[model samples]
Target chain A: MADYILGVDGGGTGCRATIADTSGKVLGTGQAGPANIMTDMDTSVVNILSATDAALLAANLPVHSYSRITACLGLAGANVSGVAAQLQQALPFANSSVVSDGIIALQGAIGDADGVVVILGTGSVYISRRNNSVTMKGGWGFKVSDLGGGARLGQKLIEESLLVHDGIYKRTPLSSALLKHFDNEPHAIVRFAHDARPNDFGQFAPLVFEYAAQNDPLADKILKQSVETIEAALDASMHDDQPVLSLIGGLGALYGPRLSVRYQPRLRTPQADALTGAVALAAKLYTQTAQS
Target chain B: MADYILGVDGGGTGCRATIADTSGKVLGTGQAGPANIMTDMDTSVVNILSATDAALLAANLPVHSYSRITACLGLAGANVSGVAAQLQQALPFANSSVVSDGIIALQGAIGDADGVVVILGTGSVYISRRNNSVTMKGGWGFKVSDLGGGARLGQKLIEESLLVHDGIYKRTPLSSALLKHFDNEPHAIVRFAHDARPNDFGQFAPLVFEYAAQNDPLADKILKQSVETIEAALDASMHDDQPVLSLIGGLGALYGPRLSVRYQPRLRTPQADALTGAVALAAKLYTQTAQS
Candidate 1:
């Protein structure tokens, strides 16, 4: 029987699980939706398990075929008190480790080393690892912080739209274009705000960047403020004189240039995804628990 | 017949009005809640009227008693389309003028002369006035911009609270105190967040500041970032070779020391309130309109 390892990145927007064999060969991957443990714990757990089953099927292996199975899941809202226990109890594996989505991101970015990994997806977090010990820097879950990520950018975009609506901001083609995209509905803006989530709002960030690229004042202002927020987070988190910092997640590429300009003197991109690091950590954990 | 003026300054948190005679003597003042026109149009009008009534009663005059009464209402959300007209139609004064709250703030600070006025109350806006012309700066409202106001600061505080909740932020006395404060009941944080206005959350700013003064790392970080925001707003609003800048609103005094330390050579404190400026403008308008 072949031993297997699985790593899952469960986010607010979606769920993704990657499977690998003991020989470190990529087996298969599976995807699902709305798997943030904080907002929808039950659905997230169900989706994560379904994704795992799908991954096993994709790999042409039955769940019970492996002599040993280890899984690590990095999930949104997993940092909420008692969430780890809840997730672990819910996500079935021969052996499972549940940690905040940030932990897996840190592991994925720099395996088993002391360093900081900044995740910029629908939300953001900074995770630092030192000697198998984990320290987190950010990822307050959309209600508070997560600056320079998608939601923050999106909030800025909507705000610009409102300003254009009010004539406080000089409307550019971009502003008009966005307003039209929302059907000129006055309540459209308010409704969006009412049901807004970090990633849900983050979807508008690219538009903001596009407008900024086109030299719109409102968009430009939004971009600058976003950059400043991310920079400040980096500054607050990277307290070491010379810390090894990495950026990951969906917005990672989009925010790269700005982050580089502001923090490259003290930061660098990681070479791996959080899933990979999670797999590695799970394997190590298996070894440790097995030894103990 | 003692000519009187009615002055109003309606912001995000409340509406403030004053009754005064032509010599700039303030006879009475009144306040009412949450009158930002952008959020509550009818309520904003009613708040202003209520405040006006209160001011009249305070002045021992009937609403219709003052001969040659003039009014200037500097109102938030007045920049919205047709909002100025709507407010004018609702106001009781026969001779009245309306403008964005920013304009009245600028007038209160520099009195129609060329300079910049940075108003930092529940929200923030910067205005630049030259002679009879106005070149508006910041004050995009809470959704779009508002660099150094209580709302932005409150937003930052909420973000920090999330960070602390997520364990990304280091545990500090400030965090615990904040958590305890918000932990009025189970899931009180969530309930508070869902219902919180910028000012409601901003009521915590002084607490954050107090902790920072006592050397709490997280609080210190929050405030330093706030200061940077003010600096940025000032920078973006003022063309380097432009006129001297003035600070107004409640937060101005709190921010003055730090702002002065950095930009003292160019900073001035306004001696008048937004309502005073509105009254002054009203007086000027009354004399002109009567003569015309």
Candidate 2:
């Protein structure tokens, strides 16, 4: 009988699930709707279940093939007091452990080493790991202090675009693009913000990155400021002179290679994605917890 | 005929109108409903008329008794494009100039001199005046910036309070007080936010300030952070090494005494409130425009 493991990285944008074996080989992966516990808990659970089922089916496993299968969820906002407990009770995993999405991402990226993991997707978080100790720097939601995240960058883009549109500042190609994209209606944009979630706003972040890639000054400034926020978070969390660093999440992987050039030798490549790490953690915990 | 001049500072919490003579004698004052432009334009106009009517009634004068009444409106959200123009057309006055509340506050304190004005009420704005040229730093609506304002402070208080109520953080006296005050149901507060206008949230800012004054660490942190935001805005907008500064708006005036110790030599006491400054500007502009 094949010993199977499941891992889920449930983020604000979507839920990603990976089916793997005990030897750490990924068999299949699947995705579903947003799985952030903070915003929509019901949808998140449904998405997680859907993604997991798909991944298992993709791995060619029967519905009840592996009764001994274990799962772990690295879920966004699961660390908010009773959230993890509530989610554990809600999800369909018979043998599972629920932890913060950050912890699992850190584990996936650096395994058991001392390092800083900065996840910058729709939301952003900085996690420092050292010898079984973990410290979180920032993740104060999208409204308050999501400095280097996609939401932050998107907001900046919209604000700057408005400035240029209003003739308050010099027009740039970014402004023109934003005006075109948003149909030049400021109030409509504001109304859009009233309805859109963090992840929805994050969809526009790639435009800023693309503009930055093309060396647009405003876009360059946006990227510079964003990098500074991430750097500051890392500096505050990591006390060591030269701590190993890895990146995860949507933005982190997208910009990880380029970011490595900025941080140079201190930056190390991640061993696994958040989903793989979650699966590994699940299998490891099931072995210990079940035995205990 | 008495050459009476009226000064009206219409805010989110309430509308305050002062009836003073050309000799700068304080005759009477009146208050009414919230007059922030962001709330509802018609309501603000009605509030202004009501407050002005009350001030006139209190002064034992019939309507239109004043020979020359020039009113300055330092209105919230007047900074938005075309909003000031709309407000100017709405209000009934011999002469009126509509501007951001920060502008009139700066003028009230420093007249035509170079200065920085910090208007802290439901929202906050920093304005710089240098040689007749004006510059604005921050105050990009309540959602994006307005960091030190009442709404932002209230949000912090509520967030912290909720965290403690949920047992996410170690309970502090401030948190306990907050929970007791809100009856331990934060969703109720969220409901209030949905139904609230700008001034409604601003009303709770005093509670935080009161707690801070009582030496509560969490309250102190929040209040201190708010002050820091204002200070940063001032610093960003200030042109010279030593620029005159003014504190306007209800919260600004209330907190002005506390801030004076920190700003000391740079903080210039206002000769009149924003209303008077707005009146002065209106009179000047009305005459200039009429002659032209």
Q: What is the C-alpha lDDT of each candidate?
A: 0.73, 0.73
Predicted candidate 2 versus true structure: per-residue lDDT over B86-120, tens digit per residue: 88887667677777777777777678888778777
Which lDDT tens digits does candidate 2 get at residues A145-259?
Answer: 5667898788778766655654445677887888788688665565566566667778889999888788888888888877876665565666564378877767876666556
Model 1 residue A114 lDDT score? 71
Q: Over the stretch B114-195, how does candidate 1's per-residue lDDT look in tens digits?
A: 6778877767777876555676645554555565677767666666666556544567888778777876222466557656
Candidate 2: residue B202 Cα off by (Å): 9.8
State every prediction's TM-score relative to the real structure: 0.67, 0.67
Scoring model 1 with DockQ, what do you get? Answer: 0.18
Q: Provide the TM-score of the second chain in candidate 1.
A: 0.84
Could you report the DockQ of all the candidates, in the order they appear? 0.18, 0.09
Q: The CA-based lDDT of model 2 is what?
A: 0.73
Candidate 1 docking classification: incorrect
Candidate 2, Cα interface RMSD = 7.0
